[model samples]
Target: MARVKRCLGIDLGSHSVKLAEMALDGAGVRIIRMLAETLPVGPDATEEERNNATVNIIKGMMKKNRITTKHVVLCMPGQTVFVRRIRLPRATGSRLHQIILFEARQQIPFPLEKTIVEYQVFDTEKEREVEVLLVAMKRETNEEFMRLVRRIGLQPIGISITSLALFNGQDIQRINFKDISSKSGGGLSGLLGGKKTTKKKSKKDATGEGTSGEGVDAADQEVLADLGGVPAFEEVRAYVNIGARSTDVAVCKPGEGASVGFIRSIPLGGNHVTLAIQKACGLETFTQAETLKIEKTAVLSGSFEFEADKTLYDMDACQAATQICDKLISEVRRSLDYFISQPDGVGVDVVVLSGGSALLGYLAGYVEERIGVPVELSSALGNDQIKCATSYGDEFDYTSFKIAVGLAAQGLGIGRLSVDFLPADVRSMRDFSGQYVEFAALIGFIGAMVFFGSQIGAESEAKYKLTKEKCEGFTQKNTGGIERARLTALESKRSQIESKATVLSDFVTPRDYWLRFLSHVYQSKPARLLLTQVVCQPNYLGVTASGATTGGANSGAPGASSGTALPSSSDPRSGIVWIAGEAEQLNVINTFVSDLEQSKGASPNQRCVVKKATLFRYSSQAEKSEYFAPNPSIKFLIRVEVQDEEGCLLTRLDSQPFMEQTALPAAGAAGMMGGAENGGDPSAMGGDPFQEGRGGGRPRGGPGMGPGR
Candidate 1:
């Protein structure tokens, strides 16, 4: 055998817990250990007691099997999960997830918030439609299993439905398709064609009355074909996994392009037949009836000889057992019929049975007779599929352990329909840890490359220095006054370039400051507030803005009061940032203003002061719908000024260069300030305050300086 890895697969059923440990190599599987423990619940056990009993049973099984690996995969019971197969348009590039969500909303009975949904897409290249298998389970149900599994000191790698896992465990994928003939255009017809069976034209025939040697209806033949077709790379078929309390019906199509057609659970199983026997035979206890049903009943003949002391009683007991088998068979036949009647239905080539109940003598033969198809009992492993570590006793039923084996197959990364329902948090943590390891490895690689490159660069530099020395001697011998004059001109040019570079190094454009200020204002503003413009006001004007007093307005305005402290009145120093905006509610605008005042970026060097916050206008009707809605609402303005930490207006070094060239006349400044208050134009408010200037700014008679100079 090639190198193999061990995986533990666990199946938690209502009455029993099955655990299987398997070592899987390429195309090979070995059963390391397989064990099943009945749940220790008593007849009168409470829910809590039942859970405790289950946990103890599981603990014992793990200890007996000596399963140490934390990498475990669990099979969620089929009855708890909702499975649906849907077909969607074949278009690509569309958001498939959105489409699935929309379909889920329509199909899922419960509210979306209560469930966790997962899906697998079938690869249908060149087909007009795509098939998808969608599975959903209640959040609480999934979390309960996860919590229980965690308590046992195991990490769940994936959680899948038992039916899907069963599909993975079998050798259905390896069956040769060329040997099977599609005579009836049914996938499974060729495999099941030899022993011809026919159905009579009666109600009993329609309701599943044909024996194995009889022919079923033409539709039934096709249905059987669809149920077990293995045409090519992909095969679609139905799987019936019977458990103690429920039977899972899953239609599986396996290959690189395979998908589940449908899956559901019928609440009929071995226990139901046992209950029927208990009721019909007047049995006093359930255990006695169960024993009689398992031991005394034979599905092949539907009758068994009992004790001579009560010959009539034996007949009655035999009749009761037969009735129980008929009921169970009826239920199975109905489930098969339902599968066949569905859209895109397929025929079942053969019925594969595996479960604790499947071991009841002659059950497989009985189902085959009634359904008019081949029925075969499944084994723990297919021929040449797995090698056993220890010889299993003949008394041990390997058929009952198929589910556990399937779960192990899923964990070994060899299961089809390998959809993981692990919670998002666990997946995220795993992905983050994996990425972290990769990142660390990359950093180490880069460090090694840098060290090697530096040594190479040092050696190259030494060679270049020696080559330059040899050229310098030839150049020195050809030197004269023309070269000297040219060198002098080059030195002058270098000095002039250095001076210009120094001046421009610390120069910040007025446009840059405007962008930074506006970004901060918008970022700090509330979502409901709509901003129109930001107007910066000079401190020279002795105006007291609302909610703030800057050095008493005229405190240091060139020739004003004793405490006047407007330091850069003539220069375009720090000024009030007026934000004009509108809101549907007055409080929203107020909140926007408050948020700006509290923002650190708006403060800029801890010199921010909220000057004015007031409603500028109330509009009842609007030219644009966004500005006015319903009743009248206020359009507001808020002004904040940046000052030095020493409580004086400050000028930045970057702004000083531009400020000197854009000094405006007092009358022109007054007109701009008036326009700022009235919300005239955004340009008037703060855009290019030095649009018309002598130099370094737009010229007075430039293209943007109005029609006349």
Candidate 2:
């Protein structure tokens, strides 16, 4: 928490929002905070409400935490997006995009206008010219998110498919969605040959790079945003995440060496089972049904054995699970067939099954028996190399956090792949059906930011290899060549720096690398902020002077506008307080002011971030301002105001005063760069970014920077 250099990732799931925060290090990505909060409107939510609710949740989170993040890498379920496998002769610049859009209309059931498109290309085979993975999602969904982000107080940088993060974390290449179980048997071991396994691969693109480019999935170029594990085989492997509502499968095939490949997502999820079970049991509540479904051995583990739960009294749990299992099998089979139908015909070596639904013991074996594909099982067992706490009771399961872990792993350049930030159009499920889907859109707005990064293990072997040249070129044992020894030591430092710097560069730009790290680092920390609204007006941005304790007229904390000459200097909270602006800008300004006024601050888990994004109402008696109304000319300029937790505006005078800067960020503070605590004060002279008010803020992660890079 020393500096304000933190990154955040969010997973807007069916039931809740899973968030992970990571701290970067010299070599890898590390976990800092983890949190999960429920999304209202119940389990069977609708897309409209779900979308709306999701946005509201995001806004609330950003507002509460005072997060002004712009580089947000979000995660979407693969099932929700469309994936198609096509054949191409070779890698081309924009040609692939053009072809995919045309093909997308044919492959995706929705009309062309309804969705946005993107694609990933893999290597070629005998019968198949080359394999290209086409991805698409609803266009409205994309716009909804962008608008919601603007509506709230933050920006949406990248929106990725959740499965990709998991795939990136698991280090999967082109998978035949069906072979997930084989991965559990030992697929990744081969890819991660050793600590020194980073010897570049031959996968190439039209650009001739060493093939690890994943920012935009290009032909021949491989993706690295998958769960990292000791390679199980030399061929190719897949990770199948059988989630509560959907299943995501990723395939990693090494052509020459380690790189990314085509990825696909489908809707075949656990909801099918839940629905079947609900019908069978005539269940009323999703909560009770979910509990009954997981605890009982019927549908999940693929085992017919019965547990000791008394709920199995009236109905036959085994039979219920059996019926649902039958249907589930068909769905999975279809997904697999769809994957196999690719021109390259995914030659999956092994399949590793993870996620909550995969908790079913021997499920991989069952899949293998049914599909003639080797299958293995893995869980919230952390990345293939590290481990996290298995703390949740039966009531709550952290096992569902695989995607988040994988995302952090990618975001941080920690575990495996570089499939980081993405457009919101990718879908993770085949069907997103539910009443909550409506409210879901609003409640799950927190879904937009996903963290995919990694934590670097202490690979002494890599260290040795890094300095081998230096060691060989030097003298030893207090001997003859002192200068040579000094040169060698310097070379060693240079080597380490070079190695780490490469990783650092990978984590920052090019998007995917950074999100991979986030998947691993961000988990359940509970420290989150929700931004309900944000106004990036003309004169409304900047940080002013303030102590740990705020004073003077309208003077809240650090990040606040100096104001357009307040009506009176006597206003107790002044020095530089914000008043409501005119029209939309005015409304937003007043909302903040009212929020500061209403009282009762944040709870222990949350805080507020009030920073000015712009400067509004700078009109003179002589000329008209840019944003000022044409005719009326902002007759009654609604100046910036402050609101409390309940959304009420605060007067220039309020004892409880919102000096509550602890859980919240100082208004207008950028990075950890203010004079405030961890970073600095938001309103210091040079620190007042809003004084000039170029942009609202940088990215909104947290109050302090993540680990050192």
Candidate 3:
């Protein structure tokens, strides 16, 4: 088994720090531990004080969780990083690096030398243009984060933004859910009831009327148009992560290859709601207001009214929280509107909410009602790829650790974006660490060479001559008359054994040629192409002779057909293979022919087994056979000429008039060459080579030819 790797993803947010320990192996990624610690510093604390608090909290969390993984992936706050999607010409290597660097200089507010810039190129529908997601951060901020990681005895490998991390986390969860659903055949829809599953309607149904004159109302049609009818906004999803001090929004196109199309950060979050509650209730401390908000506040949406027994303080807290939420939702709406107004923008179909504040009661409902889109609370606990240990407790806050999970997923090579913000000095350190073993081995080699050279130089001339003479004397003594005679006898026996083995190999090789031929054909066939018939003939002239047969049980050989005689001087290893198949597309047939022509032996120097592969006959309007009903497909017949490993068939093929004869006539002429009534089964021509103790014996017919009718 391959070695298992462990990585730690740290989310250093304003309110708390989250650390997720992930174990990755061939099986998949598993969450070994997740720990969160709140920062004790107040909002008015200095930067140095906040940094100290963060470092101390992370240290405590690691010690409590017993996490020994040193490699770390850190998530930078979205507000601190600048992210832009730029269009550039398709390039690679140094050219691509230069282009991105130039773009970064123009897009980033900071100077190039003082910023850490990373870009990821995305695939687009355009042929010549590529979309690049460029991210930049101040070098000082990056160094400060790295220093904090080092202070905690961890190695920082990658730095990613919160918005991108949220996108990645949601994407991986959806993929894992789909994979599990496929395997179980239940789709896990009942488990994730928060998500809306929109059923696609046909053109007639989408046009708002049925054949019986029953029609959908204007409101329903408008909703459908908003959801999916627009071409530029199809299948888009938004991931909203509301942290303590800010909210990150990532608009993405979701499908097999999901990508973030737009990203923005709003400076309103749960902290604003806490401050609002504090000011409304006239609380002495912010902590008291936070407690009141968590205990009594619930955002009222729609027609939900306050309870008759509710206190004035409770009402005030709820109203304050609701007002902050309203403002936050409005900001999110503005961001989405701005994105949709762009030329290449896509409308979000659904919003998935995550973060520490997403756990608030009725928040998802409020967001849904305000944003006019379906909302779901993101939970990593139910994801198939993330395995939680029993010690983590059943009440774990899965949503709050989403960014950490996404960062760890990127470290495990599961995320789509491949951006890294490690400085050059760190990269050089990692590279040197990776090659330490190689450097040690090289130093050892030099040391051994030097030691041996010194020893050789220290040896006396007389001693060297004595050692050489002793070795020569021993060789002379060993090669005397009896030894020479014994060596010659051994050589003679080896030669005789080799000659016998050669004869046996030649006899056995032909018996398995049909099996090899069939195996190669099966392996080369494309998934869309289905074979209907296959026939092999030893030589071109023998096809006519085989077709002349009816049921001559006593023709030539014991296994020969009733009215046909086996071709004389036929070599089984060399033959013409005829294949007939049906394909959904013409390209599948062409792909099959190309594979056969390019197929070669295991060794690089060995020649291709197929001398030539030809498309003998093709018909686009071929009738569907009884086996394949309803839909018609393209029918094709291929003629593949194969040669023996020894190339003996090449001489015979060149000497014969094979090329002058068309493949279709020969295929029809040998129609009766592989039939069971002629004492052979077409399927048994390649007798199971995998079966043990099999011999070099033909199956009741001439070598290489199977019975057909």
Candidate 4:
């Protein structure tokens, strides 16, 4: 049997938590197990108790699995994060970054300093401009997550948005040939924040929506001709995932070539009923309320639902379900409106609903009339594909399990969309102007050396004449040895000056020193541009850069801050963020628990967030009180450990280097006090280490780290 790689998808919810794990094999993605753990939040349960109940569910899973995760993708709640679509200059280097930072500061709701921000470029036109989707979550939220995931021994590599999971059901890049296939609003997306432009459809855009098997013979002909492979019909159909609180609609339209369509959560969700049940019954113990609500209020109620024929929900339950149906109708209307707003507005042909809530017997009928779209129970992946997936027990709920199945199916090479969309080398710093200054300074020194050589030559000629005369005069006294010693000493001084010509003569530019630096720069691998203030700043060439090659034992993660002697610490958490979210605030309860589990030795997991903030209200003398509190916001900062894997703290030298590096500009420049102005070397670098490599790869204050590090 082939070893199957497991993909686990977890949905963090207020009332109930859902987990789905699947394994991928050659045939396809298989469903392994699906779980909907009862969330014990009750009307009267203490917040702390509710938090623990949520945390324990994940903890129990880890215990049963026996191994911590290697790579895990997590999601944030739909409510906590802010998402914005932005437009910036079509740039790829540092300028691109500068613009991104600038845009964030100007547009994001919170100050740029207070958020764990990451961005994705959804649409790119290398020459024109780029469209990016920026997401910012409270740093406290991320920190808590780090803590929790660590507790269970999993590396949470990428934190994706909840809405993104719906789109994962289709390979938008491969499946979307034109604007229509991309998404209903992809045409408008192209014009997002740009000039308004309407999409014009091509013949490919006219493709009618159909099942992946509708043109099975033609697909088979190509498949056999191309790879001698059979067509996968069962796996290629569309799926609609219904969640506890929302509905995700997507259709992997299929014909010979079909359109790909996706629409996000319908306002209608199972949580509506749960909330209704909670509100209507006023139950303190949700453990019991949840059962009553699901059994009585949900569509699968009566004998068809999970429980026995007993129904806990009554007339009030009918009201909740009716409201849910109403919400579904509104969402379906909006979804179709979105479709019509697209380049072609061609509707999807097939839709399969999946989610525990989908089991409601009357839901299809209720949703069908409103959606004006065909609906059916989701079918399992075909036999070959199923063989690739882990065998699930017959009791597994297909609806709740579809996310894990889809995420896992990504492993089977179905709808694998990268949560991380930025290119690896996108942030490269390419400005090499600093090197030109150095070369120019070296040339100036060389020119000065030439002048000195001329002077020395003149002195030598005079000395030669004097020496001959002295030889003549001293012939009788035999005093030539002292004269020769003096001449040799003068020669040695010139040699010493020549040796320092490159560095000592820095900043004195000659015409065209750029060509000189460029000559050697091509050969310097990993060479970086640092402090390239090329515009008339004397210090531009007077740039004192410190860098080093890799040496000693190095861990493969980002080292520390490059003690470039910056007066500021990039880490928002260097001290306390005087805002609402405090250093002590636990935003993500489960994550905090995980971090607590991962905490080793003396260090507790640390997070940087704004504790409090205000609208910058300025007042007179007595207005400000000593007891005033700041609402700290969230920001990005990484965790530092005294230890490495296998429970070893980093070497003292290693940790100390970063600390000093992080602290240098604060401590070092504080003492320098205009040293550069008073004949101090602007190029006089602190003998710190980060000067070794380029970018954030090397640690702070290390010899190899470049300026950006």
Candidate 5:
């Protein structure tokens, strides 16, 4: 599908503003609307007043016609804009632009900074130099014009000069010069049928010879050559757009794709003719002069006469209008002459007239006769390239809209000369507007990223909070179980300590029984006999009987011999205490054995009696005497049986109550017996007796009373 675009072409003329609403697509241009609104300000009005009036008129026209398009292309008045066709050395790209810029600065009369210059390059493939069409206008002039258009809320997309626009308005593809020539033949003859020429000129007249009696001048021959010699298709056409205040002229070579080769603007136009008529007839106002020129006045030509009943005022207006028209024609001819005199010039084969003032009576015929070239009025009525809506009636002046159509064509990218005089600021604004969709898409993408990112962040935060809460609850539940396990371990350790203490106590209690037995032995020793050694063995009967010394001899008793048996007991707790002594006489030996048999303990029922007595040897004088003095002594052995009725001799005793009762008594007895053994002085024992008993008491006899002695 082809994209469609609509634009309004606004021709801001000095006396009138014309608008054409054009719709363009792949097919071509379509005219949706056309309107012309005349400005009410007079020629003598101030520039500010004129601009104000033009803006109001344009606003009214758009409103009245219901033309709503704001995108418009404007054609600046030719007089206010500079147009030049320059030939330069062939170049392209930046090099060409630089050359054009240099040329613009040199060609444009105003300073380059204060001027807006635009240019278009013509097809120069066949030529050695580049042909460029340069158009420039003062910056202030262009800005002020654009400001007035903006006052009506219209956007000016492009700006062009009137002469170039007129050149663009010519549709070369649809323009058949043969048809135009045929149509022009009738119109010219019908308007100028009474005119006659005296001489018949031919090409030979250029060499001072002709087919007639009088030869034509060199200028007349040149005019005839231009009028008659060129083929219709190869003809070069000049477009003269006679506007209200200025006339714009454009010369184009049709052979070169209708490219404009020359352009000029003349100060004389339809308004000048109206003013001339006004001054000649002494009209009260410009309005009346304009009316008269439009209604009755026409330019005079050779042999052409007005109606006899034509009023004198009408005739005066015609002559006044003719003189101004002749001057305008002379200026147009001079422009054509200048264009022809150029090095690359071609004679203008035909002249086409357009604009509001081109509608004057006999103007075409008079210009054709004066310039000696065929003249045709330009129109868009039957152009196939531009479709016009029938809603704008047949009475519409299509010729006056040529510049507007050209502007619309330029906006549609269809003009031959595509130069635009849009200011730098306006071009930037248009470029920014063109990229609006891209900007919108960028903003939307950023918004989507932000929205999604925030959503993800919020969801992550929620999940983190949930996980944290679960972990805290699990920690709280495990704390109590840990404390209970720790307390159970402590209780088990305490039980182990108590059991160890009980085992230690059982080991300690049995030492008390030995202390009590030792006390009994010390008390039973006889005078003048020293007890040498005593050994008490626990679980002694559990040993073999051969190793026992339970039976021994008694020496001093009557009928006693070396060996004597004492009574024996079978108690397992009844251990043997072996006793040894040295006596001074034999009687003393027998007496010591008797006293040991009578030994008692802490309880009345506890007895430690001698079980056996023996006389081992008799010594005459004491051998190395320590215990026996230097008297005859006998050495004897006695074995005793100690009965532990209270069970104090048991190896393991856990009876805490019984152990406590015997503890103090056993200590005191051990102390007293230790003193008696040391010659009845308690100070002779070095340390505590209780400690000595626990550690195995010291030997009872003197040191020399050991077994060797």
Candidate 6:
């Protein structure tokens, strides 16, 4: 959205403070509202007292009117400001500004540094000169007004002189001028003109006769009285604003290459008129005089007509009104005549009356009559061309709102001539502060956006967590039964793999014991010994070397000194060891037996004894030749036994590390046969054949069978 600009014009005066708000719509300007409040104290009051009163009034007015805008322009009372028209040789803009400052130093009474100066330049097409309307005010006076505005929470955008503001007010109204011939009463044409002066030259002795009127004849009267060759529209015009305390006279000639021709302020105003009336009539209070001036007073009127209580003070009012009006008229005429006396001065054209006192009865007509010019009363509120907001009252005194409206017009960029006396440094600081506020608002907006974005993200994260938990719960409920079935299948597969591993381990382990026994035998035998056959059984008992006869028992093997009968060779549990080999000498056979008894391969608690050793000589040449013996050699059969610490036979299959400890006692042949008939394989008597066990040989039977046949 595009921003709309609103301008507020404030008029500070001795008697009252006025505010006028205006806004531009397209090309037209509309007056939003106007407010005015009388000062609580008089002119003799301190600045603090005046400012406090002014601040309170402004605050109440803004609140009551609901004024929201802060862009404001102030009107400096003409009395406090210095206005000058300085003409300079044709120069560039930069040079012109410097010339004006120099001019200010020479022309202005105040020090250059102590004043705030502003200017507007007008170019003359016919002359090589530029006229500058310079407006300057004391820095302290400007600051006082600025502080007053700021105390009411407003910073003015511009500070303008009251005369320019009054001119602006009249220009915006476009007041019409009446047509009048040069011969009109006292040469009172459209605008104010200088009084015609007549001179008669006395004839000397040579001529003896002289005309009474010497200068201009009747035919040249218009020419002599006319303002020097300038057009009526461009003719010098004056604005006489009769404020409460002083009257500001400003001359603005629009087209004659001049904006503000000149401006001056007279110390006489409505208050003076009222005081004069009070002194003449012997009024007890000034308030009654003011009331009389407003009600029964008529300036320059011979008879003052009272609307109320006519019998009491009619004559006195009449005398007072005439005397005050005569004095005011003399002052006004002198001011206008002085303006016209200047070089290249066209003098005041039309007089526009404003300010609160301009509303005094017959004051405008009396001034027009005395100064021989047309006087028009105008105010910001009363201007038909300017639209007023609905908030304004119809009875509003538009006269008092002139300066404020003019100030507003300046701020709205519609003034006829705009000049500001605000110091450059102060205006720059105000602009900077405005920019700072805008920047801060932008930062706050961005921060709010970021905060909201974070809040949205947090909400999304919480929703995601809730959704994830729900998914986990659903999976556990729907897939639990299938998971149990899967566990069972895995367990069964694990058992089969474990059984195969055990079988492999058992086969490898038994080889250690078998190799032990064979190594001992080989080490003990002489070099000529040759073994063709070997048998080992756990349950067998062999004949003892002591040659004592003992019972053969599968449960317990008798001592080596007590020979015992051996079990069948195929019964691995008989704990018997047999060997058949050929040797050339008997010593070799006896040495092998003795070494076997002492070998580490024997059972821990028993000795390996040569229970029987049979030697037979070779009966056939084939046998001898097969043995590879040239001399006679015998074939020997030897049987050895080993026992546990308790003299029980050491079973062959049970010799494995795994088989050493059992949950059930080892079964005999009858139990083994019975287990086979029931359901178990007879080969299973050795348990899992490949189970991890302590043994040194391969299985004695087929792949799936045990040692015993």
lDDT score, candidate 2:
0.45
Candidate 4, residues 254-351: lDDT per residue as tens digits? 33333233335555576766666666777665465567655666443223344434354465665666676676657666765665565434565555
Q: Return whichever of 2 and 6 wins on lDDT.
A: 6
Candidate 1 C-alpha lDDT tens digits along 548-659: 2243323212222343443453333445554555566656765665676565443444334443343322232222325555544344444466432323232334333222
lDDT of 6 by residue, 516-549 (tens): 5555566776777777555554443332333212
Model 3 TM-score (2 dp)? 0.55
Candidate 1 CA-lDDT value: 0.57
List model 2 lDDT by residue over 107-218, tens digit each: 8888877777755444443332445656677877766655644554433334567777776556522222122223323332222221222334343434222222132322
TM-score of each: 0.56, 0.45, 0.55, 0.43, 0.56, 0.51
TM-score, candidate 2, is 0.45
Give the per-residue lDDT digits (tens) of candidate 5, residues 334-377: 98998899877878889989999999877888899999999998
Q: Which model, 2 or 5, shows the larger lDDT?
A: 5
How displaced is residue 632 in candidate 1, in Å?
A: 16
Q: For each candidate, what is the lDDT?
A: 0.57, 0.45, 0.65, 0.42, 0.63, 0.58
Q: Per-residue error at 648 for model 6, in Å?
A: 99
Looking at candidate 6, the ten consecutive residues that score lowest on lDDT are: 205-214
Candidate 3 residue-wise lDDT, 1-709, digit = tens: 0011667778888888988777754344578888888899766678889888988898788777677787788877788788888887765446766877888898898788988777765545555666778888888988877777677677766677888877767666554533433332243332222133354653333232100011223332322223222134346888899999999998886433346788888898888888899999999998998889888887877534543235533878888899999999999999889889877886778888999988776788889999899998876455555666887655666899888888876665455454666666776676476467799999999999999988887786669899999988887898867877899999999999999889756544224556667877888888767776675655533432232222223222222323233345555345666676667666788899889988744342243377678765454244564435665666555667776665333212222323222122222112223222223233322221111232111212232233211
- For candidate 3, the 10 contiguous residues with the lowest summed lDDT are 207-216
Identify the runs in model 3 with alpha carbons over 4 angstroms from their true place: 1-4, 176-234, 303-313, 391-395, 436-440, 443-709
TM-score of 5: 0.56
lDDT winner between candidates 3 and 4: 3
Model 2 misplaced regions, further than 4 Å: 1-6, 46-71, 91-115, 121-131, 148-154, 172-205, 208-235, 257-268, 300-315, 337-343, 346-349, 360-369, 372-374, 380-398, 413-709
Task: Write down the worst ten-residue block by lDDT for model 2.
Answer: 524-533
